[model samples]
Target: MNQELLKLDQVSKTFRNDKGHAIQAVKEVSFRVMRGHSIGIVGESGCGKSTLARLITGLTPLDAGEILLEGNRICGLSGKAQRQVYRQIQMVFQDPYSAISPRMPVGTFLTEGLVHFGMISRKEAGKEAERLLQMVDLEPQLSQRLPHQLSGGQLQRVVIARAISIHPKLVILDEATSALDVSVQEQILELLVRLQKEYALTYLFIGHDLAVVRSITEEILVMKNGAIVEKLPAKTLVRDAREDYTKQLLSAVFSVREFQEP
Candidate 1:
């Protein structure tokens, strides 16, 4: 078996409330992500799934525990080290429009990371920008377009392309498809599955949509109140969840099936 690509050991994050109370966003959470595998973290709205992504991507400082990437401790790196971590792991945020810069064209948006990492020349970045667009199932000609011109689904495709432009080892999708319509959501999931196979990408996909999560994840981690209550294979979690919370989540997801006459 392959070694783990990412590890979160007893990770915890706390926020101070306005009332001067400490809100533990993630409490002693631990998990491992092997290379080329997709791990879905799913729970209800306030279950801290997104907060966990923020912690993994270094957007928020952890109150406790360690996060290891490729078996290297990266939770406290700074300067050049931090930049290196930033390069190897990228994030596609929940809102594509908000995640992408409004000021830059699609080509510029994709190439900027290449330029920042010195992975390619400015001219090369410009050329590869078009390819990146195509890779995401978007027309290369769309490179000239601005964010406002693209539909919500199109914006998300751009976001996915930009995230993979650097060819990062890990990509965190924080509810990336939640903003799209049903057809577009299917397209995005197909795109993600294709890319994962092609690039051997390891993803930590965080979301509330169990169906959406099930579509992509090989394993599922079910969370509640900042702690993981159950960890099971994706199909097992769907059909045979053991926890009350997991059953509740599965109930909500399979509720769609309840409406159909069989």
Candidate 2:
């Protein structure tokens, strides 16, 4: 059975120039995020990694192809229907430092998002905000602080909290943990895994860091020049990658001995 929570089929996007030129950004990309599974998309910047995330989450309209949400192709949905898609889909951006609202206190932004999505009432949102903070391993008191007042890792957690506040069906993480320290990255990754278990979140994790991606992903898609060059089970790819690009990505994460060592 197709138990996928998200699916992109023959999806492609392109930008145009004033002279009627088209610049292809994504080329015939296809993948799936199954219920409660994490799928990773890895590629360098400008490789359409972020674009694909936006397309899946309905942040932007696709130039071609279809995006399915729970077996329904909502890519063509407009107006009220599209808004409904937003409530089910959310994104955690690459730079938490800049992706979130610096002026608004963490609690304010988080609760506001929850209330806007009707996930929680104002009073309940406040309490839930604190609960979510704790889920991410942040102190409740930190909720009152501005983004600038918190560490990078803490800020990323706040971003995650805000993204998941609405209890989204699919969470698109665009290099979400790339900027944090190594140790803190582990914490955030663990928090995501825990949240996925509790919430049944279907994650589409985008990053160039294969090591970080492997830590959380069930499947991995290697992209190059705006297309998926290869797709494989994360564990199998780590052990035996078929594509050269996949090999190059894994080589950076695991040395020959590291993969073989006890």
Cα TM-score per model? 0.96, 0.91
Superposing all C-alpha atoms, what RMSD in Å does each candidate have to the true structure?
A: 1.3, 2.4
lDDT of 1 by residue, 1-262 (tens): 3879999999999999899998888999999999999999998888899899888878788988999998898887778988898899999877888977787898898888889999899878767988998898888888999999899998898889888988899999988888889898999999999999988899989888888898899899999999999998987666778898888877766565667857
| C-alpha lDDT score of every prediction, in listed order | 0.88, 0.84
In candidate 2, where is summed lDDT lowest over 10 consecutive residues?
250-259
Estimate, for each residue in 187-246, the C-alpha lDDT of model 2 and write its tens digit: 889999998988888888999998779779988898988899988888777676788888
Q: Which pairs clash in the backbone of model 1?
A: none
Query: Judged by TM-score, which candidate is best?
Result: 1
In candidate 1, stretches whose alpha carbon ends up further than 4 angstroms from where it belongs are: 254-261
